[model samples]
Target: MDRGRMELYNLTLPVGEKHHTLAFLGFLAGDGAPAQAIELQARYISRLITGKVAPPTQKAIKHNLETIKNFSIVRKGKFTYKVPLLKLCDLIACEIGVYPWFWRVFLRDPVLAFMVWYGPIFTAQYRLLGPDSDWDRARAACYRAYDVISANGSQRDKVKVKRDDVTVARRRQVLLFTCGISAMFALGYLGKSRNLHGAIAQWY
Candidate 1:
């Protein structure tokens, strides 16, 4: 799963790959970060599921990331233009919640997962706007946010996805399955998949 994500980003092997995911996890674990506790619990669940495929020693090595015991904050220049994009990620993260790790190992509807994860974010947002709040409007506002992120971040252009690869390749089924998982995660986050599923569905 981690290697697939690294390839998706075209990151240099070994050290570069570890740095990227670790940096994301670091930010996620920061103090007052909404995802801190969930990340910890998810990491535990992830190790349990991976136990089916990995030996105990390997699993221990993989799961043995440093526990975050101290918290700090550093104020920096803000990019106002990206604020909407940030909100879009927050919405999707809230909608997906911690279940993607489990979902990757189980059969479940991604749509249902959204509702199951919706209670908290919706309540908080609903309170901010009181009775006048509108769900559709909020959805509309974030509609292009994903597009913007995907457009800028995707490595699809770099991969040589031939016509035959889509139609006649031996790996067609795997590609399609990956694309399906990618689509599901597009409704969520590519990083959520515990397998080789990518964020961009058109990678093949």
Candidate 2:
């Protein structure tokens, strides 16, 4: 989950990609900056997002921020623009795939497993199970499942040995499912007594 969070942060327009200087600057402007500089920054960001603005010029960035601050659109207290928590969460959710690890654990549980195999199979679907759905939600869900799965000593040892492999498989399965590929086939032939092709077709 931490890895996923880092990936999301690393993909953010401002901090991750160097090409979005104007958009980054515009986003900063939206957090309550003055008029003239905000307009300039917005134009710069529009050009940037639209590919009208070329790669950032250090002089331009420095000048724009400086000019904006001088005009009282922004200030240089910590030399950082703090994004609002809700917006930050939305960005993280979109970038890293919301609730990846949590979905893994949810899919692993017998009762919740059906939710993954069949959409909304559970009764209480909308209820929040942990903290708001983000990286923290994923971690908390995983730990909760780990506690249940590892309650037995033997099971706990198995988890210790296969933890890394399991994590990788979970992430892989999620990516595949998101792309519209079902894992039912990979689970192998359930039976040929029934038309296997029909069963697989139903999943799709």
Candidate 3:
């Protein structure tokens, strides 16, 4: 923990492209942690800054983050923070090309491809809808996650949109249709007929 915390202030340490990666882990592990999630980030961003995290310089900390990937997440008392697994870092970086070092590993397998395409289907679903949420909330979170993936997939925009839009659009449609069908399988898992009106409103 000391090493992880110290590397942030050690300017001698090279902060690389993966700099914003830690901020993501802190947010994920912060769930249900006693301290507000922002607090976890403040402490993290104190040494490292990335993404939408505040009070950070535009200075890159990716190398700084790399210094500590070997350290496991430490949970003390009510605090929870982590240096994301190197593999996780690779997945996050693959789209943006944060670290080219890990690309070969990512392309090595189809399953890894899935993680690249869609992360946890409902990262915030249970929290937002309770542990046993109904299909409606499940689908809501699924859609939200799918939207995130689809948006990021298009971030590169190397190909002209006129050419890529149709392709990306097809992928989006397939993903969303898959999401709804997956949701259907869980029908009545939380009581299917609870309220169609509410579900329909969210379908968009």
Candidate 4:
């Protein structure tokens, strides 16, 4: 395959499925509207696919269009988009679950590992709860992380297990407080301890 198709294959479905291409196309279609105008170049899309651009720039959008053109995946004429015959093969490859082999090799990078693991958690925490939110929100963020762990269904199972254990520990503390054990210590021991010697002197 050509470089642009290879890049799209590598970026969206580095693993075993081409679902992300549909996601990309859906993004382009924009809620039943025609695709947005391209404002950026192919290099920008390359940056986006590689994770260099977090939200992707207009330049990146243009780059995606150009890449599709270069790969003959789509033809452009009279300012419109058209799909061709070989493009059907590309779609089929996506549908049948073929991914580039390089992802397995590149998984060794630590930064990529962190992104695959904790990136969504951090992103959600910052967006939904903000960095300065209280511990309750922070803990909820961790719970979101736990959900991601559960959904992925991989060796990351340990992450959810650990979060579950922590949640249980917090629940136990809440139970103790509800039973008045914490309040009892404060009212009984602490209150009496402060006045014990004074009360003894009064008795004398």
Candidate 5:
């Protein structure tokens, strides 16, 4: 799961493909970062669900290839901006507390996911404001904030994503499911989503 995420960024410098995920685990462990703790736990759960296909020694050697071929992640497509874009947007909606994971919602309630992902005004009301919010004014405020962040940060993003290979493709569905858990930490730093404070209390 950790390896797949660094791959998603298409990380090229410092840690090479062979060692980057280990580097990230080092980042988490050296500092006792809460995320790696959670990841390690999730890995244990994964072992429960699928059981190990290979022993620890062979699994360490084969690594991502050994795990990913078992699941539903993109084994066939070249990576694209749309993949990350949708993933991140869907991620925000899930993290903000008013919605479940987009896929679950799409199955149970596509209308809600559509309103959250495809409709910015509706997205704002549920994401930022509670159900009792004054729709027009609250949504207008959220739109303004989005515009500011979008325009301000637009220049800083430089990944030529449309042409990149799908570096972070997961081999296991459980890994993909748990993989995005780390992204919640990032989103917790934004907006009012403060759920990660417990996980990160020591570091902060």
Candidate 6:
């Protein structure tokens, strides 16, 4: 395993020795109760990824979920049970290079891919672009950061900065800015979707 190649596709599995996080993404494609059904969902996703009938222990799934949360890949709401898919974070996980992993997931199951794609973008547009949202202003800041990073090196070097632990640590300011904005976007969509009507938000 190449420690320097820490992008999503190359990294070791977070649970069940497979892409359980991809499975978790599929679970979030619907309006499922994530907290309640995550264990069962983890089993189903593990089976799909590794072709293993056996499920990982609950503790392992929880640990992985916690790790992902720490990464700001998924956000839990305070009132509503819905998890904001955090599209930007998902995009950044691919590390400014190859297309997102969700796009690859699309080849195997277009419908699931569509839901995952549609849900996050829709929720983001609906909530993040609302009149009260500062997303426009936020994007400007992100672009400025993007400019600074782009100025520092070529695209290849940028990729190295993203994947190499030593480099990312050295460029901690950029990493934090990326993470901080993602959290803002995630938090912007956090709240009850009581009136949200769509396959993405109310597919129960």
Candidate closest to the true structure, highest lDDT = 3
- Tens-digit lDDT string for candidate 1 (1-204): 353222111011123343223222222312233442333333433443455223224333332221111111122132111112223333333322422222431233333233224322322222112222343453343334433554577676697556755553445466456757876666565455533454333332
Against the true structure, what is every candidate's RMSD? Answer: 18.4, 17.8, 16.2, 21.6, 19.8, 20.1
Candidate 6, residue 108: how far the Cα is off, in Å: 20
Off by over 4 Å in 3: 1-117, 120-122, 125-131, 152-159, 163-169, 172-204
Higher-lDDT candidate of 3 and 4: 3
Query: Which has the higher lDDT value, candidate number 2 or candidate number 4?
Result: 2
Which segments of candidate 4 are over 4 A away from where they belong? 1-61, 67-139, 151-204
- lDDT by residue (tens digit), candidate 2, 46-148: 5446665355456644544343333332333433443332233323332223322334544444323433234311112211232223434444454454445
Question: lDDT by residue for model 5 over 116-156, one digit each (tens)?
Answer: 45543333434333222354564455556556755676757
TM-score between candidate 6 and the true structure: 0.20
Which residue runs does candidate 2 get wrong by more than 4 Å? Answer: 1-17, 21-43, 73-204
- TM per model? 0.21, 0.21, 0.25, 0.19, 0.22, 0.20
Clash-forming residue pairs, model 5: 68-171
Clashes of 3: 8
Q: Rank the candidates by TM-score, best first.
A: 3, 5, 1, 2, 6, 4
Superposed model 5: Cα runs more than 4 Å off: 1-76, 79-82, 98-136, 141-204
lDDT of 3 by residue, 1-204 (tens): 453443442222223323444433233331233233333224334433434323324343453344333333443432223433333333332222222221232233322224434454233322222222353454455556667876787758576546554675686567566756765675555347567666544432
Q: Considering lDDT, which of the candidate structures 3 and 5 is the better prediction for this target?
A: 3
lDDT of 4 by residue, 80-102 (tens): 23334233223322222221112
- Where does candidate 6 have its weakest 10-residue lDDT segment? 4-13
Choose the strongest candidate by TM-score: 3
TM-score of 3: 0.25
Minimal lDDT window, size 10, model 4: 30-39
